[model samples]
Target: MASLFAFLRVISLLKAVWTAYSAFYLFRNYLAARKIGLPIRIIPISHTNPFWMLVDRHFISFIRQLPFGHNSFTRYNYRGWELADRYFSHHELGDAFIVVTPGRNWLYIANPDTIVEVFRRRTDFPRCLELTEILNVFGPNMSTVDGLQWKKQRKMTATCFNEQNNEIVWSETLGLANDMINYWSSKALLKTVAHDTRTLSLHVLSKAGFGKSFKFEGHDERKESSPSTSYKDSLQTILENCVLIMALGTKFLENPWLPQGLRRLNEACNAFQKYMTDLYEEEKQAFAEGRTSGRNLMSSLVRASQDEAKTGVGLTENEIYGNMFVFNFAGHDTTAHTFTFALYFLAANPQAQDWIYEELCQVLGDRQPDEWNYGVEFPRLKRCLSIMLETVRLYTPVPVAKWTDTRTQSLNVGAKTVVLPPDTMVIPSYASVQTDPKYWGSETLTWSPSRWIKTSNSTTANLEDEELITPQHGTFIGWSEGSRDCPGRKFSQVEFVGTMAVLFRDWKVDPVTQSGETIETARERVLRLIKSDSAPVLLLQMLHPERAPLVWKRR
Candidate 1:
C-alpha cells in the first residue's frame, strides 16, 4: 500500500511538471504566433489545471461540433464562420479565454472564387486531417486512401452504389422501414419515448450497409423479430466507442494520462481493426470460392478487395478501416439529420407533406415497393426534397470543412496574403455561407422550403433537389467540396429519400403539443447534430431526426 501510494505521488508530480511546461510552451507559442500576426489565442487553462482544463478541452471539441443543432444556437456556430469573419473584420466574439491555435495559420479562405480554386487544385488541398484520420479506422477502405489507392477502390466500390446496387440496398432498407411502421402502430402507446434520430440511422446503416436485418416490426406475426446483433453490431459498438470518445477529446473528459481511459480507447481501436481485418480475410476466402458479392456493404467492400487483389496495389486494410469510420459517423449522421429535419419541415408545412403525397401517388402507386427503380419517383417529390436540402443548408450537419495547407507558396487572400507553412490546417466556413444574408437572400436564416419552388403550384417537374450548391459554386457544402468530398453523397441521397418517401406515404406528423417549443438546429463554427428524441427505430435507410417531439398518426 505504501509503495502504491508513493508511485501515485510520483506520477502526480510528473504530470504537474509536464503540465506546467506545456503551459509555458503553449503561451510562448501563442505569443510568437501573435507577434507574427497569427490569430493565436491562448487559453488560460492547462491540461493539468483543475476544472478549467476539462472546460477548455471539451469546449474546443464541442466548439468544432457547434455549427449545427444545439451547439450552434448556443455558442454562435462555436466561432466557426464567424471566426473567419472576425479574422477578416477584426471583431472578437470571444474573450481572451477562448484561444485559437495561433496564426491565421492553416488557410483562411472565405471567398466563393477561392473556394472554387481550392477544390479545383486537388493536390494543393487533399485529404482533410480529421476526415483522413477517421477514415484510417475503417481498415484500408477506399475512403482512407489517396491517389491510386482511392481510384482503384473507387472503381469496384462505385458499383455498389450504382442504380442496381442501390436497388438491392433500398429494397432491404424499405423492408426495415415497413417493419418499423408496423411496430409503431402496434405500440402506439409507447408515447414515443426512448427513441432518437441517430439510432434510426444507425439501424439503417447496419441493415443497408452491413446487411444485418433488424426486425423493426413490433410483435407482428407476419414480420420477423429484430435479430440479435451480429458482427456488424459488435463492429459498430467499437466504432461508436471510438468516435464518441475521440471526438469528445478524451483527455478533457477524463485524466489525460489515465491509463484506464487511454487503454479503453486503444482497446476499442484494436478490437475494431482485428474484427474488420478478420472479416476482410474471410471475404477474400469467399471470393476465392467464387462468391463475388453478398447483400450488404460488407459484400460490396469484399468484392472491391477481390478486385484490388488482382492489381497487387489493392486498398490496404487501413482504407477499409477508415471508410467504416466514415460511414459510421459521416454516412449515418448527415443522412439521419437530413431525414429528421426534412420531417420537421414537412410537419411544419403539412401542406407540403400532402403535396409530397400527391406527387408520390402520381409517380408510385400506394403499394409500390421501395427499390432504386422507384428512384424515378423521387423527382416528382423533389419540391419537398428541395425543402429538405434547404434544411441541410440552414442547418449544416458539419459546421466547417477543413484542409491542411499543402502549398509550398503563400496563399494570397486577395489583399492580405497569409503564407501557410506546409502542413498547416485550414477549415472553410460552410455554415456562414449557408445562412449568410449575402448568397441566400436577406431571410436566409428562416426555414422556408417554399423558396425552392420556382413555379409554386404552376405544375412543374424536376429531379431530386437540383443541388442548391455545388462544388463549383461553394454555396452550401454539407458534404464539403474537393475530390475528398464524400463519395457516399449519392448513397446518402438514396437512403434519405427511401426513408422520407415511405414515412410521408403512411403517416402524418402532428405536433403533440401546440405550445411545445420547436428546437432550432444549433450551429457553432463547427457543427454537431443533437437529433430529436421521439424518433423510433423506424429503420428507414437514414437517420430520422423528425422522430422527435411529434406524434405519428396513421394517414
Candidate 2:
C-alpha cells in the first residue's frame, strides 16, 4: 500500500512538470510571434494533430458563428478561401499572418509579391518534408525530398513530360472522351460523372504515362482481363486506400488473418508490384538489347535511367517504381477532380458550354475526332483552357507548403518588414490569393470563365480570335509558380482541352431538376450542391456528387 501511493505521487509530479514545460514553450513562441507584428491565432492543439481532426468540423462551424470571428478557423478542411475572405472583411490581417498552434508557428501568406519572392528563394524556404513523407511509402520520390536529392529525381522526371508524351495524352483523352460520351448518352440521368472522370484520367495516365492502355468503361462495367487482378483495379485500389496503405504499409496486407478490407488491400499491393516489376524488366531488357522505343513516360524514364546508370548517376529500380507511382498519384486525381468540377460547372452554366462549343466548331470545322491534329488544333482551344484555369483558381487541388530555413527570414509586407523565426511553416494560400478581390476584381468569387479571355485587337473579330489572359506573375498559381512548379502543367492542359472539345462539341448537359423548379433555380441548387459536396480528401473532390444528377442531350 505504501509503494503504490509513492508511485502514484511520482506519476502526478511528472504530469505536472510536463504541463509546466509545455506552457513555457508555448508562451515563449507567443511572445516571439507578437514581436513579429503579424496577425496571430492561438489554438490549443496543432492543426495536423490526428486527435484534433475528430472535432475540427464542429469547431469550424462554431468559430464561424462567433461575433467578429477571424479566419483562424479556416485552417480546418475545405472552403479555406471562402473562410479567409470572410475573415479579411472583418480584420486587418494584411497580406500574411501567423497561426500559432501548440508549439509550432504556421505563417500563411496570400500576398502576390511575397508569394513570388518565396517561390524564387527555394534555398531559404524549402518544403517541409515531414508533411510529404506519406508519399515515400513506395520509395524516395520527387515530392518527398529537397536539395540535391530532389534535383536528381526532378531532372529525370521532367524529361518524361515532354512534347511527345503530351501528344499521346491529347489523343488518349479524345478517345476516352468519346467513350465516356457514349456511356453517358445511354443513361437518362448520369450519376457517375465523378467515377467516369476518374476512370478516364486513369486510362490517360496508363497510356500516356505508363505505356499501358485500357478501353474506357462505365462504373458498372466489369470485364477483368488479368488472371489475378486487373491493372486498373490495382491502381484504383491503391488510390482509394492510399491513407491506409501509407499508415499500415504495403506489407501489412500480407496477413491473411487480418480484416477482409486489409486483405484486399494486400492483394492490390501485390498485384501492382508484380505489374510494375514486369514492366521494369521488359523496359530494362529492351534497353539492354538497344531496341528501346521510349514511347511513353515510363519507357522514357527507363531509357534515361539506363543511360545515366552507366555513369553511376542514374535512378535505381526501386526509385523508378517509386516515381512512376508518384506520377500516377499526382496526375490521376488532380485531373480527375478538375474534370468533375468542370462537368458540374458546365451543367450549371449552359452559356459557358455554348461558348466552348462555338470555339470548338470554329477551330475544328467539323473535323472527325481522329482528324483533329493535336499540334494544330489544341493551340486554338483557348476557351476550354480558360474554363480549366478558372476552375483551378476557385479550387486549387494541392496547396503549396514551404518552411523557413534553419536561419531566420524576413519579408516586406505593406510598408512593414515581418520577421519569421527558424523552422516556421510558410504556406502560400493559393485559394486565398487566386480568389482575392484585390487581385481578381469585384467578381472574384464568381465562376466566370470569360474573365480569362481577352478581346482581340481587331474590332471585327469574333470570340474564337480572342487571346487568353495571362494573370500577373504570382497572382495565378494554378499549376504553382517557380522552378518547383508542376512539370505536368502542359500535360494537364492538353488533356483538359481535348476532353472539353470532344464533350461540348456534340452534347449538352443540364442538372436534373424537379418538375416545379425553374432552370435558374435548378442552376443555383446545383452550384450550392457543388460547394457543399466538395470536401478535401487527398484532394478537393465532390464528396456526394450523386446528389446532383446530370442529364445529357445532343446539342
Candidate 3:
C-alpha cells in the first residue's frame, strides 16, 4: 500500500513538471510569434507532434464536450484542421496569422500575393525536410529532398512525364474507365466505387510508370492471377497501409510476433522492393544494350538518368527505386480520390453530367474511342478537364508544406513585411485561398465545373476553341505553383480527362436512393456525405465512400 501510494505520487509529480515545462515553452513561442507582427493564436499542442496525432480525434472529441472546449486551442491543433476551419480562421485573423505552439510557430498564409512571393523565393523557404523525411524510407526521392539533389531528381523525373507518357496515361485510363463502367453497370448498386476507382488508378500507374499493365478487376472479380500478380497486390497493400508502414517501418512490421495484417504489410514491403530492384536491373541492362524503344515512365527515367551519368550527374539505383515509389504514391491515390470526389459530385448534380456529356458529343462526334488521339482530342476536352480542376480546387489531395529552416526570413504579406522566426512552418492556406470568394467569386464552396470554362465570343468558334479561366496567380494551386510544383501535372490531367470522357460520354450516374427516399433527397444525402465524410488519411479523400453507393446507366 505504501509503495502504490509512492508510485502514484511520482506519477503526479512528473505530470506537474511536464505541464509546467510545456507552459513555459508555449509562452516562449508566444513571444517569438508576436515579433512577426501577425495575429497570433496560441495552441496547446503542435499539429505535427506524433504523440498528439495518434489520439487527436478522440482527445478533440472529448475536449469539445467540455465547457468552453468547442472553441479551445485543441480544435485548431489537429491534423486536417484546415478542412474544418476553412477560411474562417483567416476571416478572423486577416490573410496571415501565426499559430503559436510549444514546438514551433506555424505561419498560415491565405493571401495570393504573399503566397506567390513565398513560392518565388524557394531558397528562402525550402520544404520542411524533417516532415518529409518519412518519405525517405525507400530512399531520398524528389519529394523528400531539397537543393541540388532535388534539381537532379526533378530533371530526371520530368523527362518521364513527356507527351508520349501522357498518351499512355490517356489510353490506359480510357480502357480502365470503360471496364470500371461495365462493372458498375452490371451491379444493381455499386458500393465499392471508391475502392474500384483506387484499383483503376493503381493499375493505370502500374502501366504508365513501369510498362506493366493489368486487367481492371472489379470487387467481385478480384483474385490472384499469375506469379507477377503479387506486384499489383504488393503495391496496393503498401498504399492501403502506407500510414502504418511509415509509422512502424518495414523492419518493425516484419517481426514474427506482430499481427497477421502487419506481417502481410512486411511481406508487401519486401515484395515491392524486390520488384523495383528487378525492374531497375532490367532497365539498366536495356539501356546498356542501347534498346530504348520503351516509352513508359520507367524507361524514360532510367535512360535520362543514364544519359546524365556520362556528365557525372545521375540518380543512383536506390534513387531510381525511391522515385518510382514516390511517383506511384503521388500519382495513384491523388487521382483516385479526386475521381471519387468528382464522381460523387457529378452523381448529385445531373445537370453537370449533362454539361460534360454535351461537350463530349460535340468534341468527339462520331469518332470511335480508339481513334481519339491525345494531341487532337485531349486539347478539346475542356469541360472534362474543368471537372478535375474544380474537384481539386475544393479538395486538394496533398497540401504542400514549406518552412524557414534554422534561419529567420522576411515575407511580404500585403503592405506589411513580416519577419518569420527561425524554425517557423510556412503553410499555404490551400483551402482558404482556393475557395476564397474574392478570387473564385460567390459560390466559392460550390463544386461548379462551368466556372472554369469561358466560351469564345466568335459565332463561328468551335466548342474546342473555348478557353479555361486562369485564376489569380496564387489562388488556384491544385498542382501547386513555381519550380517545385508537381511534375506529373499533365499526367494527372490526361488520366482524369480520359476517365471523364469515357465515363460521362454516353452514361450518367445517380446516387442509390434509400427506401422511401426521393431522388432529390438521395442527392442531398450524397452531398451531405461528401461534405461530412471526406477527410485526409494519406491525402484528402472520402472516408466512408462505400456508405453512399452509386448507380450507373446509359443517358
Best by TM-score: 3
Expressed as tens digits, the lDDT of each residue in 1-555 for candidate 3 is 999999999999998998888889899999998777899888888787878888887788788888888774755878888987878889888999988888888899999999998898999999898887777657779988899999999989988999988889989988898898988899889985888888999999999988889899997888753323589889988887788877787778868999877877888888889888888888899889888657888788889999999997899988988888889888988998999999999999999999889999998887767879999999989999999999999999999989999898989999899888889999999999998888888988888999998877667557766899998899988888899999999999999999999888888999988999999999999999899888777689988988888999987
Q: List, residue by residue over 1-555, the lDDT tens digit for candidate 1.
A: 999999999999998997787667666646544543444434334322335433542465565664552342233222232422322222232111123332223334455665666676666666654444444444556544556766777765665565654665466556666666656655433333123344556666776666665555232233321112245445444544654554544344344465664555544555555666777787778888886555666667767766767867655666665665566666765665566556555655567677667656655665656433545654455654666677776556654334545555444443545544454555555545555665667676566666655542335454333333232377667667766566676667666666666766767665444234342331210012222222112111223332344557788
List the lowest-lDDT window of 10 residues for candidate 2: 78-87
The ten-residue window of minimal lDDT in model 1 covers: 522-531
**Candidate 2 per-residue lDDT over residues 1-555, each given as its tens digit:** 999999999999997986787677768778888988887877655667665565666677777777855454544332343333532521366688887765578787877888999999988898888888888767888888899888888888889999999999999999999999999989999874998888889899989877778899898785654324688888887876887887787766687899977887788888888888888898989999999565898899888888877886888788888888888888988998999988898899999999888898889888889999999999889999999999998887887789886889987665778888887889887767787777787888778999999877687578656999888888888787888999899989999999998898999999988789988888899888877667666677777888888999998
lDDT of the structure predicted as candidate 2: 0.82
The residue ranges of model 3 lying beyond 4 angstroms of the native Cα positions read 1-7, 65-67, 72-75, 224-229, 458-462
Q: Note the Cα lDDT for every prediction shown.
A: 0.53, 0.82, 0.88
Top-lDDT structure, candidate number: 3
Task: Kindly report which residue stretches of model 1 are placed more than 4 angstroms away from their true locations once superposed.
Answer: 1-108, 128-135, 138-156, 185-200, 217-229, 244-282, 289-292, 370-372, 399-408, 412-417, 455-472, 514-548
lDDT of 1: 0.53
Error (Å) of candidate 1 at residue 14 is 9.3
lDDT of 1 at 450: 60
Candidate 1 vs candidate 3: the TM-score winner is 3
